[model samples]
Target: MTTIGDFMLGGHAACDDLFAQAENAAGDWPRAEGALGVFRDTLLEHIAMEEEVLFPAFEDESGAAQGGPSETMRAEHQQMRALLEQMADAARAHDERRYLGAADTLLMLMQQHNMKEESMMYPMIEAAAGTRADELIAQCRAIELRSAGTCTCSRHGAATA
Candidate 1:
């Protein structure tokens, strides 16, 4: 069975790969910007899946709507969104230095955020949501497919490219 953890981990890896591609493009402004665009889109899709589908399911199942880890994660998502905008602007201007700096900060934030979700939040969700977990993951996969315009969840029964 494909778990939420597995699904999210795959997204994390894919996002990292995209970022690495951007970083490797380095002096090539067009290539770097293109890769960053893909990275931003993919990351946003992952965030949306969690914020729109998983988090709500988790909050309902765990009864932490008022305040909890999900709230903290949501806040982090906002911070990341701001950083993504900054990075996008930097890329648009072809400011590699600025882009790298923002990318570094964003990477650190994402690593910490991902760890919390994978280690703490996902287990709580799995235990609380039980059989419904699969359904929620499927929903998340659908969101990814729609946002990415490509499949990113082969394990969840979606085509992978």
Candidate 2:
């Protein structure tokens, strides 16, 4: 029964953990590779969920803000994506400095991004989302679960399944 914010926030934290582990490995390519894989997928799915579901819901809920939080989050997503791509390239090339550099950027980005969402964005959603909150959140969770090859809600027009 997790909300979209809850689920995606968990994903962001998972990505952070992977980044931390990679940085802690101190140039161990194999260890970094394993952590980097988790970092990659978690970030990808987290962004996909926001863009495809949660952001749109927030936009609908608070046009007064004119998609304010969602817009900022999207920009941050781009920054995170860039760092992730760099990390991937470095990991593939087995370059410790490059990998750690990208990991450092990711850590900063994630820490700030999480703060905005947990403080400003989520409270705004709770205040303004009205009755649609429950339904929209349900749809988002269904999308996540289906994306992970689990439950199939099949309610989101095209496919939440």
Candidate 3:
């Protein structure tokens, strides 16, 4: 049975691939910029899935909004967002060095962030959400589809409706 952990990990894998694509295209400004755009879009969708759907459901189910792990994750998301903007700017300017710097930082941040979510937050969410976990996953999938403007339902291979 597919679980929330599976879905979240799938996102992590996708982000990793996108980031690699951007890195591979670093020598070509136009290609790099295009890759970064797709990476940024995909990353934003992943963030929205957590911030808009998963986190709320977890908070509601666990009642840990005041000072919880979700709050920590949200704070990290903000940091990542800042880095994303900087990376985007660097890409636009065709500053490979600057983009690489920001990409390095973002990659480390994502590594740490993904670790927490995969090991701790997602399990907590799964247990707390119980029978509603599938519903929350569907909502996340919907957000992903909307943000990406494509049917990524095959990625998770899970029921989306």
Best by TM-score: 3
TM-score of predicted structure 1: 0.89
Best by lDDT: 3
Please, what are the lDDT tens digits per residue for candidate 2 over residues 1-161?
Answer: 55545755676676677667767874788877766765566567667767777677777666754547688888998998999889878988988888888888888888988888877776666667666667767666666566566323122222432
For residues 41-70, write the lDDT of model 1, one tens digit per residue: 888888998889988888888889877988
Q: Indicate the worst ten consecutive residues by lDDT in candidate 2.
A: 151-160
Over 87-149, each residue of candidate 3 has an lDDT whose tens digit, in order, gives: 888888888898899999999999999999999999999999999988888898788767545
What TM-score would candidate 2 get against the native? 0.78
What are the candidates' C-alpha RMSDs? 3.2, 5.8, 3.3
TM-score of each: 0.89, 0.78, 0.90
Model 2, which residues run further than 4 Å from truth? 1-8, 64-67, 150-161
Which 10 residues in a row give candidate 3 its minimum summed lDDT? Answer: 151-160
